[model samples]
Target: MPKFLIQATYTAEGTQGLLEEGASGRRAAVEQVVSGLGGTVEAMYFAFGEYDIVLIVDLPDASAMAAAGLAVKASGALHTRATPLLTLDEADEAARRQVRFRAPGAQGPAGA
Candidate 1:
């Protein structure tokens, strides 16, 4: 399973709905959506800054996560951003891989 971090900000109408339904209702709704997409919500929280809410979820794959994001966006109530989270082991594996590349202003192999 792949993990995703979701940061969202509510529109005026969405804020009004939030006030009416409250946080618990919103959390449950999100949980249900994620579950329907074969994912689980690891954690969710309300924030007081650039983002109104944040969530961590474990989903089956990128497409599943994208589906979840698109569904939310389609509601026209909130703006959402989803970022894929890589585990430390995955980072380590990436760091260990080797390849060849040229820096800016540099030529190709052997400077040819």
Candidate 2:
């Protein structure tokens, strides 16, 4: 399964609803949505910042994550950004890949 880190910010109306209903209800609702797509919520939390809520979820794949993002955005309650979470091994693998690039006056392969 692919993991995702979701940062969400609610609209003014959305916050009003949250104040009335509560975070647990919203968390349950998100869990239901994720479970329906063969995924599970790893962790969820409300924060005080530019983003109101943050969630870590494990889904079957990127497509499932996109579908969930579309659904949530369409609801018009919360705006969200989903970032794919990579494990340490995955990061190492990515680093090992032969990537070509140039920087400043150094016009050559990245490793050069």
Candidate 3:
């Protein structure tokens, strides 16, 4: 499984609905949706400013993540951005891989 960070901002209509339903109500719905997709919500938080809510989630794979994200965006009440999270070991593994490339205007090998 892979983890994801979801940043969400509510629309005017979404804010109104949130007010009516309350935070707990929305949280329950969020949990249900995530769990239904074979995923788990590790943490959820509310904030002010650029984003209204943040969620840390672990899902089976990228396809499952895309399904969950697309479903939320389809609702039209809120907008979401999903970022894939990598563990430190994963980052190190990526860094260990190597390849070569030439910068723009740099010459290739001397052979004609």
Candidate 4:
């Protein structure tokens, strides 16, 4: 499973709903939504900054993440951003891959 870090900022109407429903209610709603998308909410937190909530979620793939993101954004209650997270082993593997590349103004291939 792939993991994602989601950051969300609630709108005034969203905050009003939260105040009425409470944190646990919100958590349950999130859990239900994620589960329906073939994912699980690993962790969630409320913060005081540019983003109001942060969540770590595990989903089967990028498409599932996209579906979840679109669903949330379509609600018009919150602004959400999702970033795919790579595990340490995945990062190491990516770093080991080799590729031929040239920066701007660099020399072309030997053939021209």
Comparing 1 and 3 on TM-score, the stronger one: 1
lDDT measured at residue 37 in model 2 versus the true structure, 0 to 100: 98
Pitting candidate 1 against candidate 3, the one with the higher lDDT is 1
- Candidate 2 Cα errors over 4 Å, as ranges: 102-106
Q: Report the lDDT tens digits of candidate 2 across residue range 3-86.
A: 999999998888898999898889889999999999999999999988999999999999999999999899888999999999
Q: Across residues 22-62, which tens digit of lDDT does each residue of candidate 3 receive?
A: 99998999989888989899999999899999999999999
Q: Return the clash pairs for model 2, or none.
A: none
Give me candidate 4's TM-score against the actual structure. 0.91
Which segments of model 1 are wrong by more than 4 Å?
109-112
What TM-score goes with each of the models?
0.92, 0.90, 0.89, 0.91
The model with the greatest lDDT is 1
Query: What digit string (tens of lDDT, one per residue) describes model 4 on residues 40-70?
Result: 9999999999999999999999999998889
The window of 10 residues in a row where model 2 has the poorest summed lDDT is 103-112
lDDT of 2: 0.93
Please rank every candidate by TM-score, starting with the best. Answer: 1, 4, 2, 3
What are the clash counts of all predictions, listed in order?
0, 0, 0, 0
For residues 7-89, write the lDDT of model 1, one tens digit per residue: 99999989999999999999999999999999999999999999999999999999999898888899988999999999999
Per-residue lDDT, model 4, residue 34, is 91
Error of 4 at 36 (Å): 0.5
Residue 50 displacement in candidate 3 (angstroms):
0.2
